[model samples]
Target: MMEYSDFKFKKMQSQLQEYFDDYFSKEDFLFTLDCDIEDVWNLYLDSFPDEIKGIYHEKPWHDCQRCHLWFKTMANVVMIDDDYKIRTLFDFKTIPEYQDVFRALDEFLKTKRVENLFLHDKHSVGVFRSFAEYDGGFDENHHFYLDLPEKFYEDTENLASELGDALTQRQLFEDTLNLISPDAVDTVLELVHSNSLYRSIQWKDTLEGLKDVFEEFSQLDSNCDLNNWLWKKSANLPRNITHIKNTSMGTLLLDITGGMDLEQAVTNYEKITAPTNYQRPKAIYTAEMLEDAKSKIAELGYMDSLERRFAKLEDISINNVLFANRDVRTTLGEGIFDKLRKNVSRKVYNFDEVSEISLDEFITNVLPHAQEISLHMYPSLKNNFVSLIAPLNEDAPSMFQWDNPYSWTYENNITDSLMKERVKEMGGDVDVDLRFSIQWNDGEWDRNDLDAHSTEPDGNEIFFSRMKSKRTGGWLDVDIIHPEKGKTSVENIQYKHKENMIEGEYLFRVHQYTYRGGDNGFKAEIEFDDTIFSFDYPYKLSNKEYVDVAKVELKDGNFTLTSICDNKVHYLDHAVHWNVALGDFVPVSLICYSPNFWNDNEFGNKHIFFMLKDCINDTNPSGWFNEYLNNELRPHRKVMEAMSSMMRVEDTENQLSGVGFSLGKLGMNKITVKVKTNNIQRIWNVII
Candidate 1:
């Protein structure tokens, strides 16, 4: 990572501040810059290397698997994106320890600066050869992709600066075309830029992209020179092997040495050394090069014509697309590739660099595994690990499990005072004894300094500094610290004043203040109490309930929202309350204006779980689904507690920003978000 001077950071930050002060403060202006999910992923990756270098190691692999992990982690940078099912990067706010990195958020925001960046023109999946000329042996097919973010251009100066970077790279490539030597560079550039093959959206990392292509092209004509002796002209021990069959010539011609004797054909053999000082000629592009070139070019798509474009070339067809599909496995009392298993122990490192770890540990730690972790890396050999298992198998290491992002264990035994009051109203004795406690378990090495805070009814705040407010009687009895390295620690926040806790409402919170040492293995929870609303601090919900919807709580790792209406509890899980990325919303009886947290990427992006207040289609009680919703969907504090106990999902971050395009203010109420869920939209008649 190049050292980014603090001056540069502050300079960029100042420019952003200037733009915000000049434009965002306006009363009549609407945001002109907007990006979608795909664009968001690209923009983050483009600028991420510079920003994250101080934190993460450079990408270690050149394969497609590595490519996919790159995208997943990039999505993690912008809290909105994910790898469809899971969060590869836990987008925790930068802890206090890395305040400088946290403050340098301008780099992250710069991703949204899309003045001259190209949009993703091609969204093809799978790997294939690159058409661009390259001699580097590392020129492999693409199984993963990286695209630039779609930007809304409102600033010309910012746009010009960015456009300059990409254009300069192309100029350098063209200038090299004029170089005196390096015919392979010219050969590749000529083929790739010709009308027969061209790609408008090649790669955004121009400098890196050009360098990779050049390296691959450079390998086009490399010769094998062993032990300082040239192995030239050998029909049996062939050097300068050409993959193409142009001119009907064999890959190379072996030296006859003016004799047809077997002993003379072994000129470069261990016993003979007639030309030990000779330098082998470097390989130039030939018909044999065309085949691998086509293979590499085929990855860019349009594979059928590379044969037609060249003469005397034959193309062989492979039935399957996935590398794993080509893998061979045997089950005749033995497994395929079993012979190789003896040498394959649990490896912790690859390429003899960096710490080595297992696949499970890598994903659990949210680290990058896109490059080396492949089901089958051998393009032809493939993966046969799954073929050995039977259909009736009870377990398979290859099985995929969809795990939740958030988790925690709480004391379910606690009796809520509010519940006790309702029980007494039903003519029952109330000698309740339960204190509220929320605990968090982080990763082993995680230095998660999460603080517990409670705002008492008497305007008292209890936290690390004021552990206990004298007047408010609020206390943070256990301010747990993160365990030492190699140790796992659980932190707890307890609130138990017995009857004295009844004076007023209490807002309890647990937040990660200085998040160091780990990724997503974070869990948080809460013990049910009268104070039902809790959020990581600096994140608060609007108490003003929109319609009947109120702020929900994360209890025992479940995502649920509940509201009390006519002393009945109307509650729903993440599915009923949360919408999917596919632009869908399941409206329950009532909803609130609580938008998903766009926390500190904190652009004022408006989001609503339900329809706008006036937008609700009030024509109720029509379908059988509505009947169940009205009758069985009872709204009460107790019912909410009951539902909370029954089921749970991981408490995950829900940053909604790109969703704005689908529901831009113009058709926010009119646009019908397609609901994708098993349950029907729940509607109730009771008023909150």
Candidate 2:
């Protein structure tokens, strides 16, 4: 009941700062249940104890037997949060048929053979199911009644807290000892924790541990000032600490920061300072002297209660490791990882086994808590090792692990380019390959639910929701539905070659709908036939700034980029579309797919006329546009074939021969063609 919202929580954490390095509240509580009387009968055959498992087989035919929750004890442990509340009682649900089952079991157990326990002899009482059925059979789950108390864990915590308060007061009472001589307390803790010789052990047992300090302090002159010898752990202490010193290289008193037996510490000091006026010592300090001094210190008001507090915390552990020592905390070694994995898989019957799912799925389920399981990291580093605390709540799985890191996943290993090439090599055609890779700092990308929406020219949007745009030959070939769940990966959206693909303006854009945090980024590459266009948007890829990647126009047969991101018109060397008027009559749209790759390397001695239809309304289509048009601005035969297809004309087997071609408009955006067709002069306008 004492939760974080409690008023005294902050004081608790601050008061016990050394005891706890870190602590946090669990989001929810776990369950341990026992369903029925069968569980009780079985537990009776075993030891008559609340704990210690029973050797009885489960009743198979019972309705609740399949659940196997007969008698599982929820770890009945007490926890102290940073707020300093000792939380013992947790909210629990009652089992069904409780009163009837209790009555039946009580009546049945009176005649049954059972071990002799204190008052409750024959019949068992309260089988709090989880802490429920056991040998004792319902003998109150906890010795301490866990009702919602006005100050629930308060009284228990006070035992320790009161001890600390008393100890602090005890230090105040020993003011006479410290005032008389500042070095009145033995500085044993200084030697144990830090080399600085000033204060004694943080515990009340400080004086008891001073026997070893003599040798370490031997180097310092006995006559040195105790002020110089005594050390201060924290500069921000409430009061200035001072040590007593004697002049003329005589005996010195080390500064005492806590309650110390003044008379004994002075005696010990005198022994060390005395030269004996001989070759040895004045008076050898014995273990008896140290013990005598410690006894005097313990006798101080409330210091006795401080001892009980230390006793209470003697067996304290955290993160499954004993933390009783001030110097060290612990982590399980790699040897136990497999053991832990097995225990979670075996012992916890309620949860599905962790090994059943892929490590990615496992990590996916437990993130951002499972962040230590880095997908890209090598397992050799200690920090890289994944630590999974069992999910104690009934509904959640118990464990998760990266069985093998350093290896890539099937989806992760498949890059768009590599997959495309492999598919093509196996006779799978990739008419249009679109791919993009994105990354953010730390693991913020994992929180980002990224989605790309590509709207074709005809207003057909291709997104994760609606994957395929068949009419536009567009397919969300491979998109990352849950980008965070997979490898830091790439997003590829594709479109196969279709007749209407080059109809009008084909605009495809990448939209990042959600950005979790950190620096946003993106890199996309598009491959249309032979040309590959790459775009990099660093730190600018976010929900606010969606990238309008590319716009391809097929007016008069041109699949070219008019503009890219931000709608910035990235003008090309030549206009993308031109008028391919058939016999100077009807205007038709055909693909002029002359990407940069065409002029760069692929076009080797191929003529532009090779692409035109072999028969353009009885005119030699290949030979007609050959000589009169500007071949310098044209692509190879394949491109012209795609272009001529716009007119929907038959392209026969015709060799490249556009003989006697004439360019009419000098520097204009039109190409006038005058070619001898069928022994007649023909003039045509070709828009460039």
Best by TM-score: 2
Q: Give the TM-score of candidate 1.
A: 0.17
**Using Cα atoms with residue i matched to residue i, what is each candidate's TM-score against the true structure?**
0.17, 0.26
The deviation in Å at residue 430 for candidate 1 is 18
Candidate 2 regions exceeding 4 Å error are: 1-447, 481-487, 500-502, 542-545, 556-558, 567-688
Model 1 is weakest, by summed lDDT over 10 consecutive residues, at: 382-391
Q: For candidate 1, lDDT tens digit of each residue in 1-688?
A: 1123323433433443343334322212111112343453444344344445444444322212544444442332221111111111222233332344333433444344221222122332123223223355343233332322223222445655644643443333333323312333233333233211111112113323433544544553444221011101111111112211111111011222122232222222212321232221111223334455444434533232111110000110111001111111111122322333344443333232233333234223311111111110111111000000011111211110111111111111222223222222222222212222332332345555656566555667676777766663445544556544543343333443344443445554445566553443333333333223222211222322111212233344332334322212223221211122122322211111211221222123322222111121111111111111112122221222222233222121221111112122433222222111122221111111
For all candidates in order, the CA lDDT equals 0.28, 0.31
Candidate 2 C-alpha lDDT tens digits along 167-191: 3433432332334332323333322
Clashes of 2: 24
